[model samples]
Target: MKVGTKEAAELLRICTQRVRQLLKEGRIKGAEKGDRFWEIPLFDGKPEVKEGRRGPKPNWKKRVSKAISRICVNQHLIRSNSKHGTNKPVIRVESRGIIRYFHSLEINGSCKVVYRPDKPLSCGAKLWLEVASDVMLTAFVYS
Candidate 1:
């Protein structure tokens, strides 16, 4: 016997819209359009959904309008790999802080005496860092 989409949906545990979609996509066999609606064959197994990807879409990719040309600056940010890029302009005046850069990545340098960031830094196109002046001056100054 043939059944309406609503009955088919209830029997198959799906919505009537899904049943219509399956009929439109030809996924549900033994179903044909009647005078006013689709007639799905009764006692037939549940309709099988098409196999495809089932997950949230991936994030959009960034497209560059121009070539990646490196822009040179007098100083470089130490944590340039941060999400917010390099030296973004900021207005923080009247604050006591020491502007220093990391020097050699020596073996003993990582040996740890507790307080780091007390090492002497090299100037030029190297990394630039900023630390509180009071803590920096009181911190251990490594050779």
Candidate 2:
């Protein structure tokens, strides 16, 4: 007795595509390619499925380690800068990406800072603006 790929798939409890793949891979015997379908021997047992390596590949660890190292280096630079003083440039231009420049400002005087970009920011920009300012005791007493 012979059955088409669809009927074979139903008997094997798998998809028709898998049945066709098994036939092509010669996992099952007596499978003849018909006009538009495959004729598989109904007497043959279900083909065995070999277990393959699952989940993400092992090479991801190397890439992840590189990323973590980069982050650590950036953190070290920030810590060293803070210990020395805020002498670093407030704005730094990059060669690529949407954020053309990186801006980090620190104000320690009785003044206000404003950021007015020429074009509207679409993404990759974080604006940390505080509207309210605390008045010092001396400034309030003098006023």
Candidate 3:
């Protein structure tokens, strides 16, 4: 059976723009039926949704690296030897495994550290560390 873009969007639980995007990306099969109208075919098989399929599944190490990069970009890092004194650095942790993981490095003049809990931590947890006055860092460690 053929369905319009609105029907397709409703069935897919996504915005119509997303439906059009999928069509443009060639992830879903559809055809232009008329002026400003498109038809999507109904299939018995499961809908094949593509998410990050162009590359390999991100490894844990790679995820941690990317998370750390994000944190560095978001926060300032205070170094160990700032004359004004140090502030507690903020640690953001995310995990995909049972064992805890730690990714540590010094950025700017501060020590930026990430710690993943052995078990998944609560969605929001506040942790502390020491850093310079001008530099603050956020660290995220994921399993």
Instruction: Give lDDT per model, in order.
Output: 0.42, 0.41, 0.45
lDDT of 3 by residue, 2-109 (tens): 677775665455678977877777777545556777767755311334454666642321221211222321123234324446443433323222222234534455
lDDT of 2 by residue, 1-143 (tens): 56677756655556888777667777666677889877776442332333325644333113211110000013344576699975433332221121222334333334333343653233322332322122111111110
Off by over 4 Å in 3: 45-143
Clash count for each candidate, listed in order shown: 0, 0, 11
Off by over 4 Å in 1: 44-143
Clashes of 3: 11
TM values, all candidates: 0.32, 0.30, 0.31
Looking at model 1, which ten-residue stretch has the lowest summed lDDT?
63-72
CA displacement after TM-score superposition, residue 137 of candidate 1 (Å): 92
